[model samples]
Target: MHIGKAIRLERIFDRNTKRAIIVPMDHGVSVGPIDGIVNMKEAVGKVVEGGANAVVEHKGLVRCGHRAEGKDIGLIVHLSASTSLSPFPNAKCLVASVEDAIRLGADAVSIHVNLGDETERRMLHDMGKVASDAANWGMPLLAMVYARGPKVKSEFDPETVAHCARVGTELGADVVKVPYTGDKASFEHVCDSCCIPVVIAGGPKLDSTEAFLRMVHDSLEAGGAGLSVGRNVFQHENPTRLVQSLNMIVHEDASVAEALAHLNG
Candidate 1:
């Protein structure tokens, strides 16, 4: 790893634990101002207060949520965008650049790619370009890789998830985010195949905090680096508490029950 990349990664990952609790706030570009994040600054404060390592968002929203006081969190500029209203929502396009992210004071930059989309070829091309630019700039790139296509029978299939993670690593991503394969045995296979750090996506919001924490615990047991969870953390009744629980599991090696206890206590 480049010295510059390592320095930047230190801002995102716990130095002692080598894990991260990242809150992805870039969903507005895809789903629009949903609850829990309509007030970006407040939501960001909650994340920081809970000891989250980083938060990911588009370039425009960076200043909106950045704090002038308090412990700072890592800022990752998301480079892709595709609205839910679009007929081809899976067709993510490069809406920003590594240079743009640098100008925005980003610690890292991220891109999204759906491997099985009809526009997969185009997205892959864009991802390569971004990876190249990121390399030139000595910036870390987080790839949100998913197996979403007409032919895909199950998005959470271990083999499919492994393919998605490897695609990110092959394209030069420093970190890859993919759906959890539902079990530790299967998920461990996905982690083993990827050279870069692999983080699990939050997917849809879950019914309970304990349930969400258990998923995080299971993923960590499968050898995942950490989490890039979004809705599940931000939409919880107490976003700060939820992030605290996540931090416990991801960085402190806390069990699911212990994390849930911290949330409830």
Candidate 2:
């Protein structure tokens, strides 16, 4: 790996654990300014305070969230977007570049690609180009890969998730994020097949905090590198506490019960 890329990746992934607890705040572009991220700086601060390794946001929002004080957190500039208001919401298009991320002082860059979509081909093309540019610049790339189209019955299907992860790895992503397949065994298979670091995505908010923590714990047990959860963390009643719990589970190897104790304490 390029020395620069390796150094940048360490900012995102904990050096000791080789895992990450990433909070994606790029939803403002996809779903408008939702709860938990209306004030980007505050949202970023909460996660940083809770010891999150990184936070992902779009290029435009970088100014809104950049911190001049407090503990430093890795910044990952998201390079692709598709608004929910659009008819083809699944079709993500490149809205920024690796160079844009670099200019913004981002520690890494990320792109989203929805496989099985009608415009999957175009998204793949864009990802390929961005991957090349990122390599040339020695910028770490995180690929958010998902299976969301007519043919896909369930995005969380283990095989489909594995395929999504493999797609990210094949296209040169240093880290790949995919929806967790429901159980440890299935998700283990997904992680085993991908060579690069595989992180789970926090899908729609779950029923309870325990359920959310359980999912993260299970994924890590299944060989997952960590997570790139959004709503579940930022939208939680206590975003800081939630992220603290996540850090314990992801980096400290704390059990779900122990992490829950920390969260509630």
Candidate 3:
């Protein structure tokens, strides 16, 4: 691996703790102007202040200077795009190149792949090509895999999510971001089968902070590296407060109750 790629991976991989707190700001490309990220600077600041290890964002977000805005955190740029407004929302397009990501001073780059759809073959081809280019540059690759084909079970299915993880690693994703199955016993099969570090995605925000914390706790118990959460922290009335509580659970090993206590602390 190139020195640039190695250093980038180390920054987010958290070898010391074997975990990370990543805030994914790439949602704008997929869902368009969602909560919290409307004011990108404030959102980025909230996570950085709360001790997030990295922020995953699209080229537009990166160009907004969130990384420089939060000097301490690593920036992983997403090279894919598939907007809700598109005719085919599942057909991810390669919008940014690895070269552009490197030029923009990104620490790493990410790709999105959704399996079991008519668009599956195109996405896999794009991912494999992007990964090959990224590897040539020695850039670390983060794969956001979702099982969304005609045959996909519910998004929460453990078996489907496990396949997502396995396929991503087999195709060369350095880190795989996936949904957390409610039970550790089921998700363990996911973590155990994939060789690369696995991170859990915070899906649509839950109604209660406690619910969010419970998911985070369960993911860690299942051997997840950390989280790539969006609305749960950013959409909250107090992003700083929410991130503070989440940071306790992610990096400090605080239980859900203890972390919730820090919400107001």
RMSD for each of the candidates:
0.7, 0.7, 1.6
- lDDT, candidates in the order shown: 0.93, 0.94, 0.85
Report model 3's TM-score to 2 decimal places.
0.95
Task: State the lDDT at 175 in candidate 1.
Answer: 97
- 153-192: candidate 3 lDDT, tens digit per residue: 6877988899999989999888999999888899889999
lDDT of 2 by residue, 109-188 (tens): 99999999999999999999999999999999999999999999999999999999999999999999999899999999
Residue-wise C-alpha lDDT for candidate 1, range 124-216, written one tens digit per residue: 999999999999988999999998999999999999999999999999999999999999999999999987889999999998777778888
Off by over 4 Å in 3: 1-3, 67-71
True-structure RMSD for candidate 2: 0.7
- Ordering by lDDT: 2, 1, 3
TM-scores, all models, native as reference? 0.99, 0.99, 0.95
Stretches > 4 Å off in candidate 2: none
- Candidate 1 wrongly placed segments (more than 4 Å): none
